[model samples]
Target: MQNFESLNLFAPLEKALRELNYQTPTPIQAKAIPPAIEGMDILGCASTGTGKTAAFAIPILDFLGNEKPRTRAYHPTVLILAPTRELVIQIADSFGDYGKHMKFRQTLVYGGIRQDSQVKSLKHGTDVLIATPGRLMDLMEQGKVKFDDIQIFVLDEADRMLDMGFLPALRKIVAKLPEDRQSMFFSATLSPTIRELAATFLFNPISVTVPSKALTADGVKQSVRYVQRDEKVNALHSYLSSDKVDRTIVFTRTKHGANNLVKKLERQGIVALAIHGNKSQGARQRALDAFRDNKIKTLVATDVAARGIDIEGVTHVVNFDMPVEPESYVHRVGRTGRAGAKGIAISYCTSAETKELKAIEKLIGFDLRVENPKFKFGESAPAAKGGKSASGKSQGSRRKNKSYKPHWQMKGRNKRRSKTASA
Candidate 1:
């Protein structure tokens, strides 16, 4: 167990850690902070809530201390690239908390909104710049920005960098950065591309792994339920109605499904909200705000909208529709069990979705605790009750649907290549 005082972090960082009641270093933080301060590039593998942000942020802030004079445009001495706008905002907020007492200024630039505010912030000369690939590249091409002066480059969510189809963008952005600068990358999963990036960017960097190989948060208790496709809603309704549920996030397959689930839950007297790509950013923010503030007991979201939601006290995550891609299951359940709190992830699987369940199990390298809820209408056989059946034989097996909407999916097709060039 490493303590904050022994780490020899700068006063402001140590003070913030103390204020945040961080007396002991998490496994990742314990291994990450020291070497990073010594000007070594780092490759850290850790889950979402295992204090990864602090592990990198504290070290980067210390490295970027108030030595350089302020510039007119936010020159971004420390560059942190994130996959999504929500993640960019969250990282910037964490930076603000730890770097407040220091004389450092940080700015967050991402898509999903107008660029006026971001451009204005850039003109004011920020010391640290946290941004997404698309928006940052756009700003650069518009002749409003450049990464020529960045001394430190941090790539957060390396798995997502490849997952969200941002590998090319990341390569382009990294190409523009000074090759001599320090480089670091953090992610829950280390794909081959990530390893290749480490070789291409870092110089003999110490590799750090916390609770090493675990894809999802250790604090999250994962389980699954076998149900018919039509009965997924029924199972979810039952789970929410139980006295055990406090706060929950329900993930659906599509935007329409998310909204429909919310409406279904609301009709059953369960207070719920939905967030998706089709909704206006204001509406999405409002729903997130309500969920975070405890005004909404449950939030249903599509995969895209679920990426950047950093809410605490999320008691459980319900996968109403299973994700075909195995990695997505890890990210979906990661919403809970954050900030060191225990949480639960319950996935609903149908007969047709069995392959996906098996794929997820293979990816995680563990079998989920499977539960078959005893339904109230258990004995009604379609053929026994005179209802027409395709197979005609009436047994305990109930028919189910096979197809689901994975409007988008992770293309984890081939192994990431080594010896990366300017793609």
Candidate 2:
């Protein structure tokens, strides 16, 4: 498929994709791109790491090529909206890489950094804009950025946009755009509200989903151990000590827990890193990069995939703690088994977390092979008398009705948008 080429695609894109080792088109890409290039509204439903970035990006880059800039004002010709600061940065970088052959001017906006700098980036009149809903809306409110001229508008990670609490801001921003324009929405999973929100923007969209995310990517081998609450760290130690896991990301429920886990690993003479909300922005980037570059062997984080991290070759995703929500399990383990590479997700559960474990199984629609670890393959989490069942009510569906507030609250403006969207 490396030899495969399309007339609409420019020379630079072909060469860049080859360099990155992207050969054949994934199902999501093969189906979504043609219609997108033809100016059709697209609703892409693929799980994380299905090359969704390039799916939307290749089309946008081709559409906006050689189009005059939006003058001195910050009204973008191509606006890519994402849910988190990490995603914002990643999309910007993707634009840069994909459009390297062309003179594509782009900028990114998110809340972690100073707003003044972002405003200045807009003043230069970028052609392509990637941003999170909050900072983008804030800039629009200040009259620093405009959307009247936006020709291509994309909402990447659509479900996540709702999860991050950006529905209100998304509606406000979309309301400001020209009613007739090419709009696209991409997400791992779409709910009723996401559908309602998409209807308000997308015109006759083509919706597509890669196979069931629950099927567990063919490359990944999953297993679980029902250890006592106090025994988890030791079990994880055993796994790490075996030399099987070259790189690892341990997911924990709380910010403090992630940090403590990293510290504990260090005390045991294993250097590691932790990334969560409380850490400074610089620290998070450093930790992620260090792990990716193999400077650090272990990295711990909270369950936010928006952390704009795409570290290739992640061998194992250890659920140091099982997620409270099953939908979250998709995003958590998703950090591994990326880009069609093989990976593993090992969840360490105690009787207390049995309900959470069962909830994940139900949502994924299949029972994960719960192994005793000590015995062999295809074993189940050990049964103790009256212990909670690993099969319980799915939690993914339960968290769907949430109202996510953007990380950055704009004082008076937030209340109105929040109320309307959540209501």
Cα TM-score per model: 0.83, 0.82
The reply for model 2, stretches above 4 Å from the true place, is 1-4, 18-23, 66-70, 305-308, 373-423
lDDT by residue (tens digit), candidate 2, 107-205: 878776788877887777778888888778778878889887788899888877786688888888888999888988987777788788888889989
**Which TM-score value belongs to model 2?**
0.82
lDDT of 1 by residue, 282-388 (tens): 78778888988989889998876787568889999999988867778987888888766899999987655667888889988888987755633222223555444
- CA-lDDT, candidates in order: 0.78, 0.75
Which whole-number lDDT from 0 to 100 does residue 405 have in model 1? 22
Model 1, stretches more than 4 Å misplaced? 72-74, 212-221, 363-365, 373-423
lDDT, residue 416, candidate 2: 59
Q: Enumerate clash totals for all models, in the order shown.
A: 3, 2
Q: List the residue pairs that clash in candidate 1.
A: 73-125, 74-125, 74-126
Q: Candidate 2 — which pairs collide? A: 165-404, 358-390
